[model samples]
Target: MSGNKIVAIIIVGLVHLLVGYALVTGLAYSATKKIIERVTTVDIDEPEPEKTEEPPPPPPDEAPPPPIVAPPPPININVAPPPVTVVDRPPPPAPVIPIARPAPPAPPAPPPAVSKARGVEPKGQSRWAARIQENYPARAVRSGTEGTVGVSVTVGPDGKVAACRVSSSSGSDVLDEAACDGMQRYARFDPALDDAGNPTSASWSTRIVYKLN
Candidate 1:
């Protein structure tokens, strides 16, 4: 190639390098300007306004009532009492009249009655009398129950217990029945004596008290 063409080529290459360098420098300067803008920003604080205080209200117009109090008692008086008259009293009244005590009421009157019929009171002592005593029934003795039975007996002319019955119940049926049985088998008496002193049949009620000592 010709010398002038080679020179022209070299000049063109130098011109393009110069243009690239200038463009890169311009971009870097723009980026630097943006960073400076972001870093330089500062925020300022504003002052607060002063507060005002409110005052208390004034007192009421009316006044309160006074406390109650009692008045003093009237001054004590010093007056004198009226005079008393004195007359002689008769020598202390004649000794009080003696009171007469009425005679004690008559003793209670004797009740009206007729004399009892005479029947033989059996000779109190007898061999059979002891046997008639209540024998505690087996069941009654075990149960701790005891009582008295009243018996009316009939004595034959022969002076033996002819019959007997329980005139009054001994609370326990066992005791009452036993009493009758005992009397019939064991009770015998000497014929009772009459006003004439003769033997005769008679009945007597006897109570056998059964108790454990």
Candidate 2:
């Protein structure tokens, strides 16, 4: 079929022909026999073509470079300024409570009540005139120097006259002296009473009328 195969067949035919001719002529039989013995059949087999294993290359269309995204660690924006609250300033507002000012000291306790005075008259006051007349100055009666002598007598706590003085002059020294002298000698009174009703010294003022008959 191919030219190389045809050429190889022709060469092998020529070798066989030469060997037969040498044997028939007996020119070199032994040599020819040796040549025939040495001739080996060559098998010419064309090797099969190698198989091509194409088509694993189409996956590289260029989109594999997007996976290196390490960029999200910087967004803190600096908001750390709100932590300074040291609150001890709240004690000043509590002193506004109007301290009740103690009712203006209860009006100074109204000054302990003083007892009202009651009048207490002396007893045996009438006997003073008769006693004073009995001791009238004889000189006043002789001279006819009549006058009303007003005298203040201090009665003792025991109701006897303790002191006497002329409260009003009689225009006669004799009558004035007689009035005080007589009242102090024989006059009597019931001693006055204080608010507690205890006997206290009393002062009595009265007049003595000296008349000459």
Q: What lDDT is reached at residue 172 by model 1?
A: 91
- Over all chains combined, what TM-score does candidate 2 have? 0.43
Off by over 4 Å in 2: 1-120
| Model 2 CA lDDT for position 163 | 88
lDDT of 2 by residue, 1-213 (tens): 999999999999999999998777796767788788768656679999999999776665776677777877888898888878788766565556666665555555567656543333556656767777877687876777788888888877788788888889989999899888887777766677776667787687878888766
Q: What is the C-alpha local distance difference test score of each model?
A: 0.77, 0.77
Provide C-alpha RMSD values for all models, in order.
Answer: 19.5, 40.4
Q: In model 2, what is the error at residue 165, expressed in angstroms? A: 1.3
- State in Å the error of residue 190, model 2: 1.2
